[model samples]
Structure formats: structure tokens, C-alpha cells
Target: MFADARKIAELAWPVLIGQLAIIAFGVIDTAMVGRYSAVDLAALGLGSSIYISVYIGLTGILTALQPIAAQLHGARRYSEIGEEVRQSLWLALALMTIGFLILYFPGPVLRLARVPAALHERTLAYLQILAFGLPASLVFRVYSSLTNALGQPRLVMILQIGALLLKFPLNTWLIFGGLGVPALGGPGCALASITINWTLAIVGMLLLTKLDVFRELAIFSHFCWPVWRRQAAQLRLGIPMGLSYLIEVTSYTFMALFIARFGTTTLAGHQIAGNVGAVLYMTPLSIGIAASTLVAQALGAHRHEAARTLSRHGILMAVLIACCYALMLLVLRPLIIEGYTPNLQVAAAAMPLVLIVAFYHVFDSLQVTTAFVLRAYKVAVVPTVIYAVALWGVGLGGGYLLGFDVGGAIPVWLTGARGFWVANTASLAIAGFGLLIYWRGVSKRYLQVDAVGQVR
Candidate 1:
């Protein structure tokens, strides 16, 4: 147990730090823009939501690289690892084209946000600027995934932290109009991100050449034309992963939209609660990524028992840590809410929701960790379908019924945004259990017997 725990920690800590640093860019933008101008703050908020939806959904597809490369590395098929990355890059470029179009022409998202005429231009500019960075971001995601799969997560971690370090001063200068630059406000934040994405991608390419670990893969060996067959293989795993992400994101998005009907304080409170959950999620997310890498490697090495053990151990670890985090959130609920805002009304509304999050996180951890383990097994279609049914059907649909008291059955406490939180929590629990069961059955197929019925 201790040995496996140690291995998971070694991999997970770097991933956690890297993820936190990457997310800090958005945090800085939010903090700085809030102080810069309310109008700009509103624009930043709306534009960022649009950007994240696009980013998460598209990048989720690119995550196909990690498992594929990890297995190849484990099997010591080093030559083909480069080819996998090459094909993934082709996939990334194609994805980038779609992402770029969506960001550049975000008429639908903007219309959904229903921004005032005065702020619409700023929002559009912000998204358009961010569109320019989509290629760089997707390309870098490929770089990060490949490096992590090769058991070199620290390298990607360092690069992500460096990018985060650059975000602060850049945001300060651009958002506030200093150092001979006009204040572009929300768009300025997008510009900083664009520059950082390009820099990260460029540095990543340089590392592939100079880094001894990656050099053997010859990932940059003469650019071959896209092999339709290889690209199709990646798309097989990637498309469902992408749709799962889209469904999950859209669920929360519609929740926010519906909750807005309850008035400003309720919406503000829900956002604060949602942000706290997002932050806590980094731990499990990192664990899931690390575990997926280990599981894929073990599977590739034909150590089916080891793969199953790692899957179980990873899920257990995430849930245990989530329990601890839930306790901490409960005890410090007031302090945490205080940190988000000084408004008593917002605090009052947020406090109960934070309590809900404490409970919500346990299942959230379970689902994310298990989902990644399944991904390691090259299983995505079923999980994606499960996510659609669970998150959209149970979560969003149930939330609507409870939040709006659709049948006049909800008690006062279960009505409004709190009801949404409750339903989301339940939905996560369902997903967690479903995925755990699926993983057990699937892992058995690989672990218990060979085709001739002998133990694997």
C-alpha cells in the first residue's frame, strides 16, 4: 500500500502543482479585472465562461495521447511513440481549427450571455484574441500529455508554472494600461494568455530537441503527411471523451443560467460555491491523471494484476483525500466564504451551499478518478454515454425539477439554487458508482483469464 501510495504521490504532486498554476491564470484575470472596472469585470466573466467551455471540451479530446503513449512506452515500443504523437498533432491541428472558429465567431455564446450592447464588443474582442491562441494551447496540451505519459511529468509541471508566473505581471500591465500599452481590459487578459500559449508551445518544441528523455522518440523527425488510419484510431477514443466533457460542462452551465432567475445574490452565492469545488477538484483530477498513466503502463507491460491494483488504489486514495477535504471545508466554511466576498448577503447564501459542496466533493472525486482509470483501459464510449445520462438526465433534469419546484413538491430548502446543488451531488454519486462497477467488470476481463480460460 505504501509503495503504491508513494508512486501515486510522486506523480500526482507535480500534476497538481501544474494544474493549480495553470488555473491561476484565470484567477488572476478575475482578481485584476474586478479591480480594473466593473464593466470589464463583467466582460471578463462572460468571455471566460465561453472560452473555458470551448477549451475543456476540445482539450478533452486531445487527452487520448496520454494513455496511448504511456502504453507504448511501457511496452518499450519507442519507435512508434513518436508516430503516435505525430498523429495526435494532426488531430490537434484539426481540433484547433474548430476551436478557433467557435471562439472567433462566438455569436451563440454571446447571445446566451445576453450581454449589454456596451459590453458586447469587449466580450467579442476578448474571445477573438483568445481564438488566436487555440492552436498553441492544443499543441501544448499534446506536449504535456506526451511528456506525462513518458513518466516525465515534472518537465511539463515546470513549464506550466513558468507560464503562470508570467501571467501576473502581464495581466497587471495590460489590464491597467501601463508600460506604453493601452488598457485593453478584458481583451488584455486574452492577449496575455495568447502570448503565454505561444511561448509555452515554442519552448515545448525546443525541449523535445534538447531533452535527452524525449530525444529518443524522434517526435519531430520529418513531418509525415497525416495517416488517415492512425488519425481515425485517435478519433475513436477522442471524440467520445470530448462529448463527455461537453455534456458535463453544459450541465453546470445550464444550472447557472437557470439559477440566475432566483436573483443576483443567489447566483453570486452559487458561483462562489462552484469555484470552491473547482479548486478542490484539482487534487482528484491530478490523482486521476497519474493513476491513468500508471494503469496504462501496467496494462501495456501485461501486468494485469498491477493495473487492477493501481486502479483500486487510485480510487481509494482520491476518495480518502476528498473526505479529509470535505471535513476541512465544513469546519472552515465561514472563513472560506469570507475569503470570497465581504457582502453579508452573498456570504449568507454561500454558507449553506459550501456545506453542500463538502458532501458533493466525495462523489465528485470518485467519478473523476474512476473515469480516468477507464480511459487508461482505452474505454471511453460507454463512460461518455454514462456521463450524458447521469449528468444531463439526473443532474440537470433533477435540478430543474427541484430548483424550480416544477411539481410543487419541493420544500423551501430544496428550492432555488440549493436544490440544484443537491441534485448535482446525487448525480455525481450515481456516476461514481456506475463507473466503479464498470471498471471492476472490465478490469476482470483483462486480469482474470486469458482467451483459453487460464488465469492471466
Candidate 2:
């Protein structure tokens, strides 16, 4: 158990760092744009919510490549790994087209939020520019996922840290205007993201071509047409995975949309709270990814017991770390929200939400780790149903009734963004427990099968 924990940490730390760097882009945008203009800040909040939903949904599909590649690497099937990479790229391109169209024509969805005219135009522009970067973003996701599954998270980490360094300068210049560049405000963040994403994609591909390890697999040696059988297999796993992500993200996405009705101050506050939650999520998410990679590889090698052990350790570590984080967040809630904006009202509005987010971290960690582990087992469909019922049905639906005070039963304290935050916290708890129970059942079944085979 101790040795397994170390292995998880060895792989998880780099992924944690890389994920933090990626998440910083949003944090920087929120803080910098919050200072630029309240309107821009609100637009940033709304625009990013929509963009994240689209991005996560699409990338979730590409993530199917991780387990497939990890298992292949463990089985020592080097050549087959290359073909999976090719098929994934094909899938990425197709998904990109769908994502791009949704982002480009975001008006229909934006209407659901009923964003005021002051924020709508800028939010629309933000989504449109992000649409231009969707393809590059998806391409880099393929690179990142492939590297991670092969136990090469450091490769992705280095690039992410580099992108973050670039992100600060670009965000500063484009957002506030400098070097003879006119300030683009909130939309500037989107522009900077596009530039950075494209750079990462191009350089990542170049590295794949030059890297000794990657070269061994000949990932780019030849272009093969999409194989329907492989594509179908990928989609079979990828679609539920994608929908699971979509359901989880859109639950929060809809929260932002519904909270928009409260006012810009409240919405901006929600963004701050949400961004902080995302930052804290990196640690557990990295652990989940590391464990998933190792588990998939172990299963591939027919070491089912090892895979089960790794999953158990990963969950234990994530929950413990999350508890520590939750305590720290509760203690520092005020100081943290202060950094996001100078507006007293916004900061005050975010206080309770951040307080709730502190505890939300624990449940968030639980659900995410279990979800990723389940994916490694190629058991996605059940989790998707769990998420949809828990996050969407429970989280979103409950938030609506509480936030809107449907029939006027909600308490005064729970009638606005507070209501939404409370509901989401509860929903995470539900989703986490549900996924954990399901994971245990799956593990038990796998062990039973192995035992029966051994007796035979």
C-alpha cells in the first residue's frame, strides 16, 4: 500500500502541476478582467461557463484514447498503440467540427441564460473567438491524453507551465491594452487562449515526431483512414464518457446561467467561487488520472488484483487530501475572495458561496476520482446515468426551486446564489456516494470472476 501510494504520487504530481497551470488561465482571466470592468467580468463568467461545457464534452471523447493506449502500452503492444492514436485523431476532428459549430452559433444557448444586452454581445464574441481555437485545443488534448496514459505526464506538464507563463503576459496586454494593442477586455482572454492553444498544438505535434519514445511507436509514420470498427469501439466508450462529462459540467453551466438572473455582482462572485473550486480540484483529478492510467495498465497485464488495489489507494489519498484542502479553504475564505475583485459587493456576495465550496471540495474530489477510475475499467455507461440523475436532476433541478424560491418556500438566505451553491454542494455529495458504491460493486465482480477462473 505504501509503495502503491508513492507510485501514484510520482505520476500525480506532474499532472497536478500541469492541471493547475491550465486552470490558472481562468483564474487570471477572472481576476484581471474583474479589475478591467464589471460588465466584462460578468461576460467572462458567462462566456467561460458555456465554453467549458463545450470543451469538456468534446475532450471527454478524446480521453477514451488514454485507457486504450495505457492498456496497449502495458500489454507491450507497441504497434497497435499507433493505430489507436490515428483513430483518436480522426475522432477528435469530427468532434471538433461539432464543438466549433456550437460555440460559433452560441446565440441559441445564450438565450437560455437571458443575459442582459450589456453582457450578451461580449459573451457572444468570447465564444466565437474560442470557437476558432477549438480544433487546436482538441488536437492538444489528444497529445496530452496520449502522453499521460503512457506514463509521460511530465511532457504535458512542461508545455502547460510554459503556456501559463505566456498566458500572464498575453492576458495583461490584450485585456488592459499595451504594446500598441487595443484592450479587448474580456474577449482578450479568449483571443490569448486561442493563440496559446494553437502554439501548444503545433509544438506538441512536433515533439511527438522528435521524441525517442514516441518515435518507437511511429504514431505519425503513416496516415490511415478511420477504421469503423475501431471508431465504433472508441465511440462506444467515448460517448458515455463524453455525456458524463457534459452532464457534470452543464450542471454547473446551468447554475451560472440561472444565477445570472440575480445580477452581475452575484454572477461575478459565483465565478470566483467556481474558479477556486476548479483550482482545488486539480489535486484529486491528477490522482484520479494517475490511478486510472496505472489501473488500466495493470488490468491489461492481467493483474486485476493490482488494479483493484491501486484504485482503492487512489480514492483514499484523494479524500484525505481533499479534507485538508477543505479546512484550509474554510480558514482562508475571506482572503481568497478578496484577490478576485476590489468590488466590495462582489467580494461580499462571494463569501458564503466560497464557504460552501470549502466543503464542496471533499465531495467534488470523491466523485471525480471515482468517475475517472470507472473509466479505466471501461465502465462508463452506468456512471453517466448516475451523473445525469445526480448532478442534473438533483443538483440543477433543486437549485432552481431553491434559487427561484419556487412557490416562495425557500428561506431568505437561500433565495439567490446562496441557494444554488447549497444545492450543488448537496448534489456533489449524492453523486460522490453513488459513484463510490458502484465502483465497489464493479471491483467485487472483477475479483469474483478472477477467483472463479482460478478455481476452474
Candidate 3:
């Protein structure tokens, strides 16, 4: 048990750091844009709310590559793993192309959302520019998943660092027009991201080709219909997992729409809180990824006992990290909000919301980590259903009833946000507990298989 715990921790730490860096990029981007104007910041926020639906929704489905690849690696099926990678590359390309088409037609969608006329143009521009990065982003995810599955998470960290480095200077140049280039304002950040993503994807592909295990498999040498079908099977397993993530993320996306209707200032505050929460969320998010990979690999090796043991330790570690994160948010809530926005009202409005988010992060951690593990077992449907119910039934439904339907003073609306958080936490707790139960049953079945010598 101790050995398994150590292995999980080793895998999770680098991933946790990489997640933090990704979050930091958002924070930096928000802070930089905030300096320009509150309207610019608001536009970025609203635009991002729409953009994230595509980014996370598609990436979530593609992320299934991690556990699938890890399981194959653990089973010593190197050739199959190579085939899976090739299929994932093609799958990512298709998804990215579809996403690009969607981005090109954002006017209809933005009009549907009924965003303020003033913010609409900027938001559309930002969305279009950001759309160009989708292909690179998807490709990067595939490479990152393959490397992590190979038990080398540090490569991801390095790749992320490289991307971030490029982002900072390019953002500065394009956003502010520093290098004899016309300032593109809010849209500039998206352009910078697109450039950085393509660079990372190309570099990641090169690095992947050089890996020892991948080289030995010669998966690059073969391309056939059978391999494509097998890869499609993995995607089928991943779709539910992807949908589960979409359900959760889309709930928040809809919530952002509701907040947008309130006013630009309100939307800006909401965006700040959301970005901060996303940054803090990196810790648990990375831990979940690590847990998923470890659990899948252990199961593939027919070490059901080890898989269960790793999950227990991973959950414990995740909870502890969540606690620390919540504590930091509590102590530095004001500083955190103030750092991002110069507008006094925006900062004040966002402060209370940050507190609500702090609480959400705790349970959010548990639910996400547990869900990742459940997906590794290919039991995604139940978790997806649970998420839909929680987000809509509790979080969104409760927020509407409390915030507006049962209207009152400003304090009441403020409290309503917290009520939404409470609903989210409750739903996450239920889902997390349910998954633990399901995992126990799966573990027992695997154990019986081992006893019957069917595992080998």
C-alpha cells in the first residue's frame, strides 16, 4: 500500500505543478487585460465562457487517451498503445476541425446568448482568434496524455513551460502593440495563444517520436482499418467521460450567461471569481489525472488490489490538498481579487463570490478525482447522470429559485450565489460517495478474476 501510495504521489506531483502553471497563465491574462479596462476584461470573460465550452468539452473527450494508453502500457501491449496514439491524433484533428467551423460562426451563437451590443464585437473577435489554437491545443493534449501514460509527467511540465514562456511575450507584444505591430487589444491574447499552441504541438510530436517505448513498437510504421476501429472503441469509452465533463462545465457556462445579463460589471466580477477558482482548481485537477492514470495502469496489470490501494491514497492526498487550497483562499481572498481587478466595485463584488468558490473547490476536488477513477474503469454513464442532475437540479435550479425567483435585496442575491455553491457541494459529495461504492464492487470482481487465474 505504501509503495503504491508513493508511486501515485510521484506521478501526481509534476502534473499538479503543470496544472498550476496553466492556471497561472489565465490569472496573468486576466490581470493584464484588467489593466486595460473593465469592459475589456468583461469581454474577455464573456468570450472565454463561450470558448471554454469548446475547449473543455472536446478536450475532455480526448483526455481519455491517458488512461487508455496507460492501461495498454501496464499490460505490456506496446504495439496496441502505439495504435491508440495514432488513432487519437486523427480523432483530435477531426474534433479541432469541427471546433474551427463553430468558431467561424460565432455571431449567430453570440446573438443567441444576447450579450450586450457593445461587448459583442470584441467577444466575437476574441473567439475567432482563439479558435485558431484549437487544433494545436488538441494535439498538445494527445501528446501530453501519451507521455503521462508512459510515466513521464515531467515532459508535460516542460512543454507547458515552453508554451507559457512564448505566451507572455507574445501577449505583451500583440496586446499592447509593443513591437511595431498594431495593438489588437483583447483579441491579441487569443492570437498569442494560437501561435504558442502550434509551436508546442509540433515540438511535442517530435519529442514523442523519440521515446524508447514508442520507438520499439514501430506504431508509426502501420496504418490500417483495424487500428482505426480499435481506436474508435477507446473513443466510445471516452465519449461518456467527455459528456460528463461537458455537463459540469456547461452548467457553469450557462450560469455565466445568467450573470452576463445582470450587467458588464457583474459579468466581470463573475469572470474574475471563475478564473481564480480555475487556478486554485489545478491542484486537485492534476491529482485526478494522476489518479486516473495510476488506477488504469494498475488494473491493466491485473493488480486490482494495487488499483484500489492507489485510489484510497490518491483520494486522501486530494482531500488534504483541497483543504490547504481552501485555507489559502480564505486567508487571501481579498488580496487575490484585488490583484486581478483595479475597479473597487468589481473587487468588492468578487470577494464574497470567491469565498463561495473556495468552498466549492473542496468538494469539486473530490468529485472530479473520483470521476476520473470511475472513467478509468469505463463506468462513465452513472457519473455522467449524477453530474447532470447535480448541476441542473441543484446548482442551476437552486440558483435561479433563490437568486431571482425569490427576489430580495442585493444581500439576498449574494447569498443566492452561496446557495448555488452549497448545492454544487452537496451534489459532488453524493457523486463522490457513489463512485467509491461502485469502485469497491469493481475491485471485488477483479479480485475474483485474479483468484481464477483469468487475469494473466
Candidate 4:
């Protein structure tokens, strides 16, 4: 137990820090844009929703690469890891191309959302500029996952920190027209993001090449048709998992759109709360990643008991972390909300929602952690189905019915956002418990076979 606990922590800490750094990049950007002008800030709020919806959706699809690579690595099939990475790269490239094409000409789509006319042009410009980063961003994700799976998460952290450090100055110079550059304002944020994406990808690739484990895989070797077949096997296993992620994340993204109908202030306040929730949630998210890696590696070694033990340890750690964050938010809600925006109206409107997010984070942690456990077992489809039903059925449906159909006020609509979290929490609770039951059943079956052999 102690050994398993230690392993989970060892893997989770670096990942947690890396996740926090990513969140810091977003928060810093929001702060900088807010400082520049409210309108720019608002445009960023809207544009970012669009950007993340696609970025996260595609990345979620590519998430299968990590567990697949990790399982292969654990089994000492190093050559297959490289092939899987290559296939993922191609998949990411294809997805990014589609995203860019759509975002570049998003007029018809944005119009369908019922957003305010005044903000339309700025949001479109911001979206288009941000679209340029999609390919590089997706490429970086593949590299990050591959390296991390090779048990070098520290390198991923270093690369991400380098990117985070550069993002601020890059945005400053490009947005405000410093260093002899023209003032691009909100669009500058997109430009800076694109620059950072490519830099991270290049630096990460160079660093990854230095690692003996990856060097052995010779991932840069010419793509083989047979290798592509192996890669397709990974996608077949992973795509369902990816779709599960999309279903859950898209539910929230859709909620963001629903909130936007209330007005810019509501949407901006919602962004702040959502961003804070995201940052805080990363603590557990890192734990989830750790669980995925540990569980997958354990399964590959056929240590089913060790895998189950590690998962329990992860859940315990996640709950402890969630409690700490919940308390902090409850104690410092005003300070946290006001820190993001000075608008009294926005702050006041956001307070209750922030508190609600604290509660939501608990279930969010459980769902993600358990989901990763399932992914580790390569049991992706069942969890995906559970998430789809919980997210859309209980969460989104409830929110839509309560917020728009019943209350019909912005604050009421805002409160309705919690429904998704509620449903998420319930679903994860059921799934986590179900996983425990399944694990026990498998252990009993193995024990029964061993007992029979012993009697013979």
C-alpha cells in the first residue's frame, strides 16, 4: 500500500505542476487582456470558448495515444510506441486542418449562436488568428503524451514552463505594439499563442530526441504502411475514449454558449469562474493522469491487484485535494473573484457560481480519475457511454430545462450551469463504485482458479 501510494504521488506531482502552469498561462492572458480594455477582455472570453472547444475536443481524441503508448512501453514493445506516435501525429494534423478550415470561416456558425452583434467582428478576427495555432498545438500534444508515457514527465514540465514564460512577453509585444511591432490588440494574443505553440513543439521534439528511451524507438523513421495498421489498432481502441472526452467537454462548451445568450457580462463572469475551476481542477486532473499511467503499466505487467490498489490510492488523494480547494474557495471567494475582474456587477454575479464550482470539482475529480482507470484497462467504450448519458441526459437537459425554460433570468441561467456538474458527480460516483465491484469480481475469479489448482 505504501509503495503504491508513493508511486502515485511521484507521478502526480510533476503532472500537477505542469497542469497548473498551463492554467497560469490562460489566467495571465485573461489578466493582461482585462487590463488592456473591457471590450478586448470580452472578445477574448468569447473567442477562447471557441478556441478551447476545438482544441480540447481534438486533443481529447488524441488522448488515447498516451495510455496506448504507455501500455506498449510497459510490455517492452518500444518499436510499436514510435509507430503509435507517428499515427497520432498524422491524426492530429488531419484534425487540426479540419478545425482551422472551419474556424477560418466561422461566420455562419457564430451567427447561429445568437451572440451580440457588437462583439461579432472582433470575436471572428480573434478566432481566425487563433486557428493558426491548432496544427502546432496538436503536434505538441502528441509529443507531450509520448514523452510522458516513456516515464519522463519532468521533461514535459520543463518544456511547458518554457512556453508559459514566453507567452506573457510575446503577447505583450504583439498586442500592444511594443518592440517595433504594430498594435494587434486582441488578435495579438492569438499570434503569441501560435508562436508559443510552435516553439514548444520544436523544443519538446529536440529534448525528446535526447532521451535514450525515445531514441531507441527511432520515431522519426519513415512512416510504414504496416506500422499504420498497428496505429489504427490503437485508434480503434482509443477513439471511443476520445469520443467520451468530447461528449463530456462538449457539454460544458455548449453550456458556455448557453450562458453567452445572457450578455457579455454574464459570459465574461462565467469565463472567470470556469477558468478558476479549471485551474483548481488540475490538481485532481494530474492525479488522474498519474492513475492512468500507473494503472496501465500495472495491467501490462499483469499485476491486477496492484492496478486496483493504485486506483484506490489515486481516488483518496483526489478527494483530499478537492476538499482543500473547496475550503479555500469558500474562505476566499471574494478575493478570488475580484482578483480577476474589478467590475462590481460581474464580481457579485460570479460569487455564487464560484461556490457552486467548488462542489462540482469533487465529482469532476472522481469522474476523470475513474475514467482514466478504465482507459488504463482499455475498457473505454463503457465509460464513454456512461459519460454521454450522464452529461447530456442529466446535466445538460436539466440545465436547459431549469435555466431557460423555467427561470428565464441570467442569474438563474447561471445557476443552472451547476446541473452539469451535479450529473457529472452522480455518474462518476456510480462508475467509480461499479469499477470497484468489477475489480473484486475479477480477483475472485482468479482466486478460484488458483484454489482449484492447489487442490489438484
RMSD per candidate (Å) reads: 1.5, 2.7, 3.3, 3.8
Residues 277-325, model 2: lDDT tens digits: 9889989999999999999899778788899999999999999999999
- The runs of at least 3 residues in candidate 4 whose Cα sits more than 4 Å from the true structure, single-residue gaps closed, are 114-118, 221-223, 226-228, 257-273, 331-352, 404-456
lDDT of 4 by residue, 204-223 (tens): 77765776767878787665
Model 3 TM-score, 2 decimals = 0.88
Ranking by TM-score: 1, 2, 3, 4
How do the predictions measure up, each by TM-score?
Answer: 0.97, 0.90, 0.88, 0.86
lDDT of 1: 0.91
Model 1, C-alpha of 419: deviation from truth (Å)? 0.7
Best prediction by TM-score: 1
List pairs with backbone clashes in candidate 2.
Answer: none
- What stretches of model 2 exceed 4 Å from their correct place? 31-43, 110-125, 172-188, 260-269, 334-351, 407-416
